[model samples]
Target: MAFKRVSLIVAVAENGVIGKDNDLIWYLPRDLKYFKDTTAGHTVIMGRKNWDSIPLKYRPLKGRDNVVITRDQSFQADGAIVVHSLNEALEIAKKAGDEEPFIIGGGQIYKIALEQNLIDRMHITRVHEEFDGNTFFPQFDENKWKLVSKEDHAPDHRHEYSFSFCIWDKIDDSQ
Candidate 1:
């Protein structure tokens, strides 16, 4: 079976930080809303740590199918489908009829997916500020991706930092 699209969705800081410890470092409500809105009906694949970071009340992420990747075979997330690998998670999503599953991650999962070239598109919320963090988004070659769209947002009463929502599609070498 094949998928029409498989996207990676994340919020990164100017310095490439994605999180601190196992939780998000910043509190950008707009970015959170964007994530929820964009991936509402799709399957969200995440690592065990990422799944763990989600508050209990929001586990299974209400409107999405939560696929959690973990090495521990006995580990079970009550409301999520547990898989041993990213490929396994993808297969579950594919079998569930999700054409465009989203890889919503922790540091390791993102690195593995990128290294395996399993991503088709990326939806990124670029926060325009540097932060101190232990986890980071992997660096990718800009030449290999085409920026499809970008919408910039300025800081306001509700938002502390300026940010931009950017969509990038992987460049097809065949063309």
Candidate 2:
């Protein structure tokens, strides 16, 4: 079966941490806006906790298909589709035809997607500093991917730290 375009979206610190205690460690309004603008019309698949981490007011992210992956078959997220596995989520995304599915994640989902070779590209926000966190972004072989684009942002009144928005495209050896 042909899979639709899939990408992983995340923000990681210098130490590779993404979150702590189920919440983001930093407050970067621009990064959040970048995320919203990029994933606005696409399908976004995330782990259950990641879905929950969104404030109750923003439970279901607007303007995109929100697929929450969880083990609980009875789990329900308002305005979001709850699925059991990554494959199921991808299948749903494929049915959408045009919009690519982006993995907006917690650590485990990121690791699984990378390991399963289910990602075609990556949108990573590289934070310039580190913070204490229990969750981390997974490590992967950098040689397997190519950096296609990047935009650096300097810290300002709204953004606490300097960061870079990086886009990586997966290299297909079969080509």
Candidate 3:
């Protein structure tokens, strides 16, 4: 079956930390808004742990199709679709008519997607500071991605750390 654009969206610290204890370590409201705005009408695929980490009130992220990947056969997520693998999740997203499906991850899921070469684009918020964390965004070869755009924001009364919103597109090796 044909698929539309597939992307990964994440926020990473200077040290590549994304989260800790299955939760986000920082409170970047602007970044959060950016995430919501960018993904409002698309499908978001995530690992089960990532799905659980979301607050109860935000479980099925509003205005988007939530597809969770889990290995447990009996697992169920109310208001969200649960699948056993990334490929299954992607299929669901495509069948749902999502023009661009996003992989909103926990560490392992991100690593798997990268290793499988399943991502076509990436939307990253690069936090300027580093923090102690158990979850890290998987590293990829910078040479294989082309930075499409970037917007920097400095810390203000509302934001603590400086950050840059970066958009990257995977280089088409077949070209």
Candidate 4:
């Protein structure tokens, strides 16, 4: 048996904006493809509102199990596993397998996971611009994390957007 850890995969603007009106703040085909390819076979956890925000056709992600995190006692979706807290989400993730599941989300899920130390890895896209956004990712002390890799994606014909992909891991203070 192996240990389970929480991982988040997200793309945001340089200004830390994540979403607006329950939808993504920006669109870049390369970034979207990176997200889909990286998370294809993993489980994905998100808050109920985020689930609802996705279109009906895209609600249940293809080739990946969808786990909806909700505080309501009666929350359920057609093909989603509903969990009340991050603990329960992690428990279910462990049963799924050792490989960390993707914590795909809006703002609330990121906030809670950051608080519980549930996040082990982050695959982030720093889009080189900013816009008005309703949701924001929580800010953390940089001393607690170290960047492992970065890739600069040139603006493509399909998407006139420039972004940098970055991966980071949490530093163990006890070590």
Candidate 5:
């Protein structure tokens, strides 16, 4: 509830690989469907790298809001509210009526959001595999978060790789 809620969605391999040269670690269709289903009608916040990495067909993510952050004034996408900083992103999210803005990431952007206390929950799908990576997820701090739920899933015939969906919520020190 600090500003608007932010949730991070990521698929990391067993070896902690999040991305390889600005692309995803794997090409599993199931993961894509999971992403589309969860975020289909939500506001999404991301940095320039994440925005550029989005394919044209999935650019604005049908039926959802897209907010992109960048220092470049020319960084604009139709239907995506572009901003210069995280605070601006929050302001844009404010207009969306207190809905959680999904923090679909690229390494640096996720780092910034985590450091800023913007991420409220993490919707991570851990792929049971490893890959060569150019970018990796930041080490999660258990002191700041707690795993709330998880669902282990078998690989669909199309995906060929098993995965676990996890949800982590912020930890309260008041307890």
Candidate 6:
């Protein structure tokens, strides 16, 4: 099966940090809701660490096909499919007919997906504040992507910082 689109979904701080100590640095309920709504009926692929970081109680997120990528052959995640590589995960998503499978990640998985040019779009929740963290989202070539849409939101009761929901599409070089 051929897949038409592979996208990345992430919340990044102003300083490019995405997580710290294997967990998210912020608790933005709005962002969480946005994530759940956007990926509800699709396939979500993440690295093992990212999968592990999810609070145990709400894991294997309902209403979506979950694929966990890991190098460890013995790794098993209840209620989720475990694969050996990004390619394998992609194949599963493709077979599932999810044209826009979301690569929801840890730093390393994001870096690999970006480097492999496996991503066709990005759903970014851009937090307006800088954060100190050990895990950072990988830098990509801005020239290769174009902003498609953006919605800025002010800080609310459930959020501490203002943020923007930005969608970017990879520019087709053949165009």
Tens digits of per-residue lDDT for model 2, 78-165: 9998999999998888887635789999999999999999999999999999899999999988899999999999999888899999
Which residue ranges in model 2 land beyond 4 Å of their true spot? 1-4
Q: Score every model by TM-score.
A: 0.98, 0.96, 0.98, 0.93, 0.91, 0.97
Of the pair 4 and 6, which is ahead by TM-score?
6
Candidate 3 lDDT over 40-59, as tens digits, reads 99999999999999999988
**Segments in model 6 whose C-alpha atoms lie over 4 Å from true places:** none
Query: Model 5, stretches more than 4 Å misplaced?
Result: 1-4
**In candidate 6, what residue range of length 10 has the lowest lDDT sum?**
1-10
lDDT of 4 at 129: 85
Candidate 4, lDDT over the whole model: 0.84
Ranking by lDDT: 1, 3, 6, 2, 4, 5
Q: Which residue pairs clash in candidate 6?
A: none
Each prediction's Cα lDDT score? 0.95, 0.92, 0.94, 0.84, 0.82, 0.93
- Quote the lDDT for 92 in model 2: 88
Candidate 6 clashes: the total is 0
The TM-score obtained by model 1 is 0.98
What is the C-alpha lDDT profile of model 1 across 1-175, one tens digit per residue? Answer: 6799999999999999999989888888999999999999999999999999999989989889999999998999998999999999999999999999999999899999999999999999999999999999999999999999999999999999999999999999996
**Per-model C-alpha RMSD:** 0.7, 1.3, 0.9, 1.4, 1.9, 0.9
Q: Model 5 over residues 10-82: C-alpha lDDT tens digits?
A: 9988887899888876777877888889877777888888888888887877877888899999877777889
Q: Pick the candidate with the highest lDDT.
A: 1
Clashing pairs in 2: none
Cα lDDT tens digits, model 4, 1-175, are 4455568988888788988888886779888899889889888888898899888998798888888999899877988889998778767877888477889886889988888887888898888888789888888677898999999987877766789999989988896
**Candidate that beats the other on lDDT, 1 or 5, i.e. the better one:** 1
Preferred candidate (lDDT higher): 1 or 2: 1
Q: Which one is best on TM-score?
A: 1
